[model samples]
Target: MQHLLSRSWTFFIGLATGMMLTLAGSGLASKPQDSPAFQDAARIYSILQQIREFYVDEVAYDALVDDAISAIVSHLDRHSDYLDRNEFAHLTDVTSGEYAGVGMELAITEQEVTIVNLFPGSPALEAGVVAGDRVISVDGQLLADSDAETLLMGMRGPAGSLMHLTVQREGEPELLNFALERRQIDVKSVSQRMLNDATAYLKINSFTQTTPQEVATALKELALAPQLSGLILDLRDNPGGLLDSALEVADLFLDEGVIVKTRGRYYEANVIYFANTGEKISGISIAVLINGRSASAAEIVAGALQGNRRATVFGEQSFGKGSIQSLFPVQPGEGVLKLTTAHYFTPDGLAIDGKGITPDRFVPSQVVLESLLTPIINPLPLNTVVAYQGEKKIQIANQDNQLRTALQALDHPD
Candidate 1:
């Protein structure tokens, strides 16, 4: 109670004094504080006084104030949130895709922070972390009740600093503990490999500033292979990033067309983008893979390519987050407010907010895919059926239904 009162009173007093000084300079300080111009401000102060005096339980006044600000912003949309100074700094680091940390890719699954992937040369990878590992604790703090954002906060640190992680892996009796030193890890958003003799696979984990160049380089390298017949652009489980990066990637394949259009109440927010003369991979047969986790910029690429009839979209529907968030800077070094300025549409004029892009060839993802793709069925005992709840047992050549279907489609493209 004392702490809150001291902090709140200190800040408001200074702010009030500043306003008074400014008004005095304008020769308006002599006006009564109860005047119409100051009515709402006085009322807010009165409410704050009442809360400090009569509230049953002591509350952190600063936290209450920030919560009020967040609540006001929450009325806007689900994607909008309040960011204090620290969170704003973290946001910058995240969008830049460069930070001093372990470089573990995480996904929130049923309120649990689970590892989805890891950067190739990351501290977490060196510490022996793998996909599907559930984070149980961090630095001795249990993560069961911790939110994903809070867990992420604990993951970052200064370079050379050490952090501990405990994870639960399937079929392992002992929990895996890692003591890792933080390093400057640049998350690679693009990965490429030759899937088969004639097909190349390129997986974009996210859209970052360097993604377009990385993709172009990958395509050029793949084109040099004499056996290359098709390319698979995988965006499955990709939570998207920069819109401009996605536009650049779309331009690599599209010759000319409106890639995406955005509309909003603000005059400046309504805009459109069209592909220019930079179609480097126009003649190559391309297949895009998507799932419920693919969103935002990923959706932009999928929608653009699919709308332009440049690629065959495969896999499940995408995660629909078709909105443009513009960051408005506050006073220097304070922070920035990320507000959704416009709702974006596909080139074909479809606004996919809740309804994601439907693939041309829809294959069920995850466990369902395993079941459908695993054509080699084991014979069971007569008059008996047993259920095994564990890791997947089947291993087939074309076990990935989406990839297999994509390969087949590429092989038989008309």
Candidate 2:
């Protein structure tokens, strides 16, 4: 059913604790292994069989498992939960070369959806969907005053799906239109370029399986330039992927220190990650850019670099996800239990779960408000007084703004 798919989940503490106490008093003391646990197991099996045979409607076996997993994981922390087979496949396939969409990460605001970053060779990039372009309409349907995320949901579908979108670019008088057919998105995690003769720009979209090697290659490419002095490591819209990859990437910039430490309920889960003594970019001025979309491994990198005083962090706060999820095999080859096994702390022992990593210098974004939003809710005229919709967005207007800030701060070091 459409209502039963799931994500992060947690258990009810009072109920769970009470159940355990009761079981301890009545069951474990009596039989050690064959008491309330067995009874409850039998009861659940009976109930499930009864529902399948005599229930009002026929339920698929797969649906039953999905619902069961969702219910069981409901009482864990918000970061802990289950992943169905399809979801697990996609998750494990994160570094896979192809996905069906225009291949761009978007930041939605009150009035528009801005392109945060575009995947290389993606339809959006090929059709010139540059960062900072705000979408106005899709397939001739005006999205004026419409929630940008909702519009984006409509954009992704089956492969070969065609979408005609109109976007407003900054400092442009006319809107640009493109007709793009959705295809498998090819991901390019590391993008590097020279901002100037002495400055380099390196962006890691997400920490994927190949990210460590990609980052190494990117750095080598940047180092090819003779006069590279300052570097901008962009993790603005990077939704983190692999923890190990993040650790490896952070090790590249740090000489020696604890990158992060994980605390789990079980002793086996708790662990500490330390950086080795090989800093490829040693003595090079580094500036790390993070925003609301930076999370998980991205936060790990930023916190590690910042905590060690190896980089100047400049931008908005991060997405505040400090928990680590481990995928335990459900059976030999069926599915996996995506368990939120532990909470990770920054090197400086800051709680990053709810409190994100704050930047040293806060630079407000410079956005161009479109005409479409100007008329409609110009919409909650009282919005200025009420709940602001500009919540958590990657607020860097363009790549240059943050890079400029980084270069200035690095040059001055005063």
Best by lDDT: 1
Q: Tell me each candidate's TM-score.
A: 0.77, 0.72
In Å, residue 297's CA in model 2 sits off its true spot by 0.9
Per-model C-alpha lDDT, please?
Answer: 0.68, 0.66
Model 1 is weakest, by summed lDDT over 10 consecutive residues, at 1-10
> 1-414, model 1: which lDDT tens digit per residue?
000000000000001000000000121245577788588657777887789789999989877766666767879865554556766566556545677887776655455766766778888888799877888988888887675555556666789988888999997999999998888877677889886777888998766567799899988887887878788999886666666777788898888998888787877667788999878765678899998777777788899999989888999988776776655544455444556667778999998677778999888742332342445421211122223337654332324667777877787777
After superposing candidate 1 on the true structure, give the runs of residues whose Cα lies further than 4 Å from its correct spot: 1-65, 168-176, 366-398
lDDT of candidate 2 over 14-74, digit per residue (tens): 0000000000011113444467877876787787898889999998966786788778887
Off by over 4 Å in 2: 1-39, 96-101, 106-116, 127-180, 367-399
Prediction 2 global C-alpha lDDT: 0.66
- For candidate 1, what is the lDDT? 0.68
